[model samples]
Target: MAGTIDPDAGISAAGEPITEAEALQRLRQSEDQSQQYYAAWWLGRNRSRHPEALPLLLATLRQRRPRDPGAGVEENAIARNAARALGKLGDAGAIPELLAALDDEDDGLREAAARSLGELQATEAVAVLLRRLASGPAGAGAPRLDSPRLQEPCEAMLEALGAIGIAEPGVITLIEPFTAHDRPLIRSAACRALLQLSGEARWAEPLMQLLDHPQLQVRRAALMDLGAVGWRPALEPICHTLAENSLKLIALRGLVEQGAHHDATIQAGAVLSAMDSLL
Candidate 1:
């Protein structure tokens, strides 16, 4: 059942050529949803094989079809797939289409668009992405309808901003407030995004503060982001974290990943101790 629901959802496109004409024809005219998905998937996957597929993939996102007529609902599975494929293609040309898709009514499509924009590191899309974060569908302050729909887009929007790597003073100002949002996930994302924007140790100070947040998830996120930024000043705090918490593996992995080897022997002992406790 899982396979049938989305056969190509997780499948990578075959890089071999199927002839540009055939792939384009199938993508534009095929009635079999799988064929359409494969066509777009392949073109994006092996964009070097057929560059023309980029535009076709963009067009597909604009065209809509019904998912369940009985339920009076339309679905753009093809478009959603196309949006993801565009990200895989890594073409800057797709940025405009993806930015427009950010406003799409379909939650899935919007999420895909956000993901692709991040993939392209589209600095131009930053303002629009910020707008979506502020007031678009499933935005920060929107009433929660479906939990995933409400939060997934917000998460993607924050992550995409991070990926864009823009540290403009204005943009940082816009994001700072979210660091204290009532929601832990948003707060977590904000901390990570800020670190991504500014790799300076000073910027990571905020995430270090979050390490003591009341919520475990928030604390974990803070630890992970601290490691991701490789902030050495937090090394002692992370090491101290191992003494009181069961998540020794997380702290050890964080220290190792960041190359904080000042206390190699101590960290090794902590790791062994943690492993022994697990056993």
Candidate 2:
């Protein structure tokens, strides 16, 4: 069931080759939903700094399709991708449109918007996101939702707060409880947020523990969370993660880069030497 739900939402054209101009045309005026998704993805994928891309992507946020109550996923895929594109575009101007997307009826759209809000580091969104997290995950623990595609985006919201770097006591108080969340992904996300927000190494413990998570996705998310937090103490633990070397390398590189700026104890020579084993 999990495999059935493609992240690209079944649009082969999402990968189809097209000129940048063509991508712009589709993103700007294409009536086709798939084209909209593809266009947003393409523009963001190339990091297109085109002036029109920002407004066009923001405009796509208003596109909505009828709710598919039976299948349970009602998000407008184009809008979700547009949200994702706005994040990659790295413009704070999209924050308003993304904040509006938080209230979208679709769980996936809210997730995308939350993630983009984080990527943009929209500090203003902290309060709104705090409220959203307070509402609880959209599809948690209810077997009836049958959303194998992982409906609850509570993790994304938590991660966004971390990226925004709000260290307020209230923010920490709100996010701390989620560190014990039943789901590994949420737990990792919470731990990562706590560590990033507070600069506390203790928060790194849970994420490192997840290096042993039974599920590959959970473990992968754990790896990402650790790298995002930039905790150099996790260096040795990250070296021992059971994930693929490609993933470990990415995480390790992130750790190395982060340690360069923040952790004086981090020895670049030793860190690169550790990668020798992976190589």
TM-score, one value per model? 0.63, 0.88
lDDT of 2 by residue, 64-137 (tens): 66568776544487888888888889888898889988878787788888888898899989998887767444
lDDT of 1 by residue, 74-121 (tens): 357778889878887878888988988887777667877887787788
Which ten contiguous residues of candidate 2 have the minimum total lDDT?
A: 135-144
lDDT for each candidate structure: 0.66, 0.77
Q: Report backbone clashes per prediction.
A: 0, 0
lDDT of 2 at 3: 15
Residue 121, model 2: lDDT of: 91
* Candidate 2 TM-score, true structure as reference: 0.88
Please estimate how well model 1 matches the true structure, expressed as its whole-model Cα lDDT.
0.66
